[model samples]
Target: MVLRRIFPAMYTAKDSEPANSKNGTLYLLRCVFFMGVRKPPKRYFLAYCLWSFALNLCSTFYQPIGFMTGYVIHLSEFSPGEFLTSLQVAFNAWSCSTKVLIVWYLVNRFDDANEILDEMDKRITQDSERKRIHEACSLSNRIFFFFMSVYMMYATNTFLSAIFIGRPPYQNYYPFLDWRSSKWHLALQAGLEYFAMCGACFQDVCVDCYPVNYILVLRAHMQIFAERLRQLGSDPHESEEERYEKLVQCIQDHKTILRFCDSLRPVISGTIFVQFLVVGLVLGFTLINIVMFANLGSAIAALSFMSAVLLETTPFCILCNYLTEDCNQLADALFESNWIDYSKRYKNALRHFLHNLQQPITFMAMNVFTISVGTNISVTKFSFSVFTLVKQMNIAEKLSKTEEEVENLY
Candidate 1:
């Protein structure tokens, strides 16, 4: 399949292999989905735009209609469960807008994604430790794809439940405000909305996975560079001049890796920031909905959906942490090398490299929040706080209603 050829692995097959032979199923999916092409064809570009437009339109309207119906018109006053549902609906609508923004960012900055892939391809093909790095990257890609597949299954199941079981055939949760009540009309509306959600989810996975691949490749390069640094003066057959040359080459590689990290920031930082920001709210609302209606079938399905959302948002933090740790290890690796045995000039070069490594290569979210394990911790804490607050409010509202009923009895 063309998709399989386009979507699977970052590294191309060895030149000795037949071009036709390289088009394996797994490889093509990896290429098409995550490892985007340098120049996407016109049709692909148009499809991307159409998908983005649909998502944007749906998300853009979803929130306003939810607010008007839930708050302004007080439609959710009938029950606490309905109120919780309203809040979750509003939050999901808002979060979808963020997805649209991320999709837009990914489409606009696709060239940067292609460049990262190209750099990875070069390193995997040319590096002496290609086999090790290739294996590591392949492992990471598999883990990523496995997570995505699980999320997709969960999402599909949730959507199907929402369509068949959660709502009447001639109605949906979509705030279409005014429309014909025909079953076919409702089905068509629900189908378009479902299609938009699926498309956005797929795009979201692709955009997020691109950064994962880049970070993995970057970590691989750093590992290889660290090994070279460690082996700098250990080769007995190499002369002083040869050792110095190798040291210079290692310095150059370090700089290239750093430059690549810089190039990656602009492509992903804003999208990651938005993702982190929204995940907290989404999680909070989902939790509130689950607690309010624990036995409700719709709530159970929504819980599954939100679990998938969390899984999707988590890799940004994990991969960023990995990159930071890998970059920091460069200094330690260099320090542990046989640098003391080298000439003064070579020692000076080591000093320069160590100085560079002092500032660890860290990814930022929107140039403000650093993406790390700590950020993940902070987001979790924030989500918990929001959930607690919403839970308390619900409790208080219930208590107030109980008191009102008691007064009427008196």
Candidate 2:
């Protein structure tokens, strides 16, 4: 009832098309056959598991860097005696959360899936002139695992070194701990933590969002195709019978596509909400802890950066919402009365819309994540790389007529 009210233009004849028997049978066969392939190499799998463990350790070990740096930045001087205790607590918590996320990513392969999916999708679409998607798909796992290993090892070692030097900051905060350490260690730790946090966030984003973006593209493709079919027979002078048959066929196809989309939505939506809850809870706890123990500058910086990460992630959330809306939008377009005319050029419009939708979603989910990782993790070098990539994409995209053409065509 609510849907009907909001989409008054979207009511169409109920479609009850039989499932694609061939594709169904083939899907089952493929799954069964592929299930026989032995798991990825034990060595590689072990490496990844270790990588995840180390990442969490380093993240935990050097967690205080952000707080330290923030405090230093705000004060323009280091006061190890004041912030040591708070830094310790912050570092420990950060490490634990970072580890948990690493474990989560590894166990579920959510991040890995996104990377491979993006690579595979781009190879299929953007690189269509050269390589086959089949080849691309086969190589995705290899490339991702290689990249993951190199990244995790370097990140882990860097943080560990930072921790070794900076451990004294905590001791300094509590004179009772009775440990002596140099001020240089604290300064070094501060620098290391900032760089490390960036790495963790950037890499994690790359691994998770790319695949979701691919799925979004797939959804757009189906919607565009349905729209195309609807336009094939649109004619004002056509008899009611002819129009009815065309609409009926289009409805049937839409239902088929819609069912597939509906089946997948639960997976996408569930994962998204779970991540949101987890991130929110962790950040909330961090905030409360900071308020209770830490002073203003450190607390503000931690909170501000956390807020920035969340805000940066806003595009992804919006993309998810847009996908759901697209489905219903197509449903509404199906039932439009004036849409019966071929002269409306609905098919062409839909193709353009589908293509246009893919860009922002892809940029937010894949490109943004990659850039974020580089910037967050490698502040000295890759930070600028991420920034430059994002800046370039944004500027080039604006200057280009692709979006404008698509909108006008649609």
Note the Cα lDDT for every prediction shown: 0.59, 0.39
Winning model by lDDT: 1
Candidate 1: residue 212 lDDT (0-100): 64
Worst 10 residues of 2 by lDDT: 18-27
Q: Residue 343 of model 2: what lDDT?
A: 38
The CA lDDT at 223 in model 1 is 78
Candidate 1 per-residue lDDT over residues 1-410, each given as its tens digit = 67546654544434343222112123323433432322345778877666445554554445335445446554423344445544554555455456545545555354454454455445333434665555555655665566567656655655565566433211224555332466675567556546545544554555556566556556656777777677678888888899888778777777667666676677577667776776777677667667655346656666765766666557767877777778678888888888787789988988987888867777788888888778877786676788888666777467448656856776
Residue 326, model 2: lDDT of 63
Off by over 4 Å in 2: 1-46, 56-199, 206-212, 215-219, 235-271, 274-308, 311-313, 336-410
Predict model 1's lDDT versus the native: 0.59
User: Candidate 1 — worst ten consecutive residues by lDDT sum?
Assistant: 19-28
Error of 2 at 352 (Å): 27
Candidate 2 lDDT, tens digit per residue, 20-100? 112112222222122221234466776655654555444434444545545555332333323333443354345334433
lDDT at position 43, candidate 2 = 62
> RMSD, each candidate, Å?
5.6, 19.0
